[model samples]
Structure formats: structure tokens, C-alpha cells
Target: MNVKPPSNAIPTTATAHAFEFSQVTSSAGEAWIDKNLGASQVATSSTDPASYGDLYQWDRPADEHQKRRTATITTLAVNTTPSHADFITATGPEGPYDWTIPNIGDVDDALHSAFFARTDGSGVCPTGFNVLTECN
Candidate 1:
């Protein structure tokens, strides 16, 4: 399956290096995805001499360094149906009818190598084949 990351979903160097990861699972046959955006709290007491401690302590003022952006992943099955010669002839030849976002984990795994690289859809979808369509 080919997965396309939402437009404007890339993270910057500072965000990527300090980011925490989370998983989002969509219900079968449903459209639209939900994930919490922003920096996650790191434990204050867990730090040792080797570390500088959590970025935001529980008792301290909440960290206001992160912004939230919601993104949705859509999936579509490739069509195997054939088109009419008249339709093809009248209009320019077209490719597949539609596509769905690839599984999130698949995209995530593909990005492991470039964990710190600044990027947009390049790291995730890599393939430039997103299209507009309806989903349930």
C-alpha cells in the first residue's frame, strides 16, 4: 500500500530531535485520523548526572514551546477496472483512479534512517501521488 503523509506535516530539526513518538490507529472503514500534537512531558525525577533532566518538570510551569497540528491519513484501493476507449481517446490518458495513505508504521519505519533530517512529504510518502477523494 502507498501511504501519503498529509501536506505540511513535516517536522524541523529542533522538533524532530526532541520529539516523542506516538501511534494512531483508525477504526476499520473510517476516514479522518486523530493525534495529539505538541511536546510530551518528560519525567523530572528520572534524570541522572548523565542527563540534564526532563525538558519540563511537573511542578514547573507548563512548557509552551510546542504547537498542535492535526493531520488525517486516507486510504484507497487501487482500481483494476478498465476505462472505455472513447473516454480515453476523448481525454488524455489517465492512471489509477485513486490511492490511499500507506500504513503509518510503514511510513514511520521508512523514515528511521533520516530521523533528524528536516523534511516534508519527502521522507514519508516519497511518492508524489496524493489526490482528493471521499472516505467513510
Candidate 2:
């Protein structure tokens, strides 16, 4: 499951082999990382904003194509504080992904504050959008 931020909150995503691409777009690449890999574990910068790429645990693989890239990280809980929260992966004139959104649920309550529609136009939840149930 992907961990999506609240509609009121900013959007964040998982990191990928950004530089590997012929031409890298800092914000676009990082947004993909935040949405897919989860938030970064280190400090963020323009080059590594939100530190999305660093979130994964890349290990050499037997396959050459995957060898250069590290393994994906899959051991994170849905408990990040607002101050240190790095979920907002993309912003401004850098990314194509939308961050401010809301998922569908018949029940409207404070707990459902974070749930949002997975995609911009799709009524259904996005394939990997993570649901945030509780906010402390």
C-alpha cells in the first residue's frame, strides 16, 4: 500500500534511480519516489528534496538491469510527525503529480481527514495510495 498524505497536507512519494534517466527532473523524480517508496529517512535538498531516493535499501541484484539500483524499502509505519514529515514529494512548477487530494469514504469524520482520491480524475482510489486512518 502506498502512503498518501492528507488532502490538506502536501503530497509525497517514493524515490527511484533519478540520475539514471538521460535527463533527470528533480521534482518529478522525487514525487514518484515519495508516492511509491514512502517518505525519505534523511534530510532533503533541491537535488534530493524530501530525500525520497534515499528511502529505499538498494542492494546489488543478480540481474544486471537491477544490479545498479538498490532494493525497495518496505518497512515503514504510518506514524510521522508533521514537523519531520517528508511526505510532500512534489510541488510548484516541477512535478506532474497532484499533492492536495482526498479519497472517497461515506463516513466523514476527523479520522478520515487524510484519505483522498488516488488519482486526479479517477473516482476510485489510486492503485498504491496509502490510507492514513489516524492523525496525532
Candidate 3:
């Protein structure tokens, strides 16, 4: 899923820490948010702070770590299900950083899943809603 890093991904994510899921549905059965997750308002521009919402680690759960002001921990999780809520920072352009990515995988591979084999979006997305698959 080398998604072209859509600029719309953020503006599509605000408000309320983005914990609210599946609040709206399209006629084609597509779900979307009126506001970016964790954002205070819908995005007006790339510099709109309110629309920045919270930063989510790929596949990470909608927990405290998603908060914009959450503390950062320089440690990477040993497993997919991290028990804590600290924003894990990338180890620069050196080594693996996040959980959803493979240690030796491509930097552009948005769908890289070395340890992540599940496609159900469990633990990350709210129940009844799932992270968009590559085919979506």
C-alpha cells in the first residue's frame, strides 16, 4: 500500500482525539469523519494546527498516545500490542522506528507488515470500523 501519501489523509483524520469512529457513512458504505481525529476543527490548510489532530503510530490504538501533547518514549515496542501510551520516535534515518513497519522494509511501503499479519484493524480502529485496506 504505497499510498501516494495523500495530503487528504490528515485533513480526513480531527477533533476529539479522533476516537470517535464510524460517525458518518456514505451512500456507497464508506465511512469518513467530518473532522480530523484529535483535531479541534476541520482543516483549513496544511498549517492548520486544529486540524492536525493527534499523531497516530501506524496501526497503534486510539489511546493516550494519539494525543498531540502526549509524552514521547524513544523505545520501540517489542511486539505489535504495546502496553503503554508514549509516542515512539523514529531512530532517525538509521533503523526501524514504528511497530507496523518491517525493520528491513521499504520506507515508502505504507502497507509494510513484517510482524503485522492481521488486516482486520483490530486494536487500532474502533469496533465495527476498520483501517482502510489497500484495495479500498
Give the top-scoring candidate (lDDT). Answer: 3
Instruction: Enumerate residue pairs that collide in model 3.
Output: 13-36, 13-37, 14-35, 14-36, 14-37, 14-39, 15-39, 17-38, 18-37, 18-38
Better of 2 and 3 by lDDT: 3
lDDT of 3 by residue, 2-92 (tens): 1111222322432232354224445864555555545666679989887776666765566688787888877667644578887888564
Q: Pick the candidate with the highest TM-score.
A: 3
Q: lDDT tens digits, residues 1-136, model 1? A: 1122344452221222233433233464222112212225322444432222222111111132111222212323222112211111111122242222234343333333343132342322222212122233
TM-score of 3: 0.53
Model 1 / residue 9 / CA error / Å: 10
Predictions in order: lDDT = 0.25, 0.29, 0.51
Ranking of all predicted structures according to TM-score, beginning with the best and ending with the worst? 3, 1, 2
Candidate 1 contains a number of clashing pairs equal to: 4
lDDT of 2 by residue, 1-136 (tens): 2334333433333222232211112544322213223223343555654445323111111122222243322223222212222233333232333222223222243333333333331211233333333333
TM-score of each candidate structure, all chains considered together: 0.19, 0.18, 0.53
**For candidate 1, what is the TM-score?**
0.19
Q: Order the candidates by lDDT, highest first.
A: 3, 2, 1
lDDT of 1: 0.25
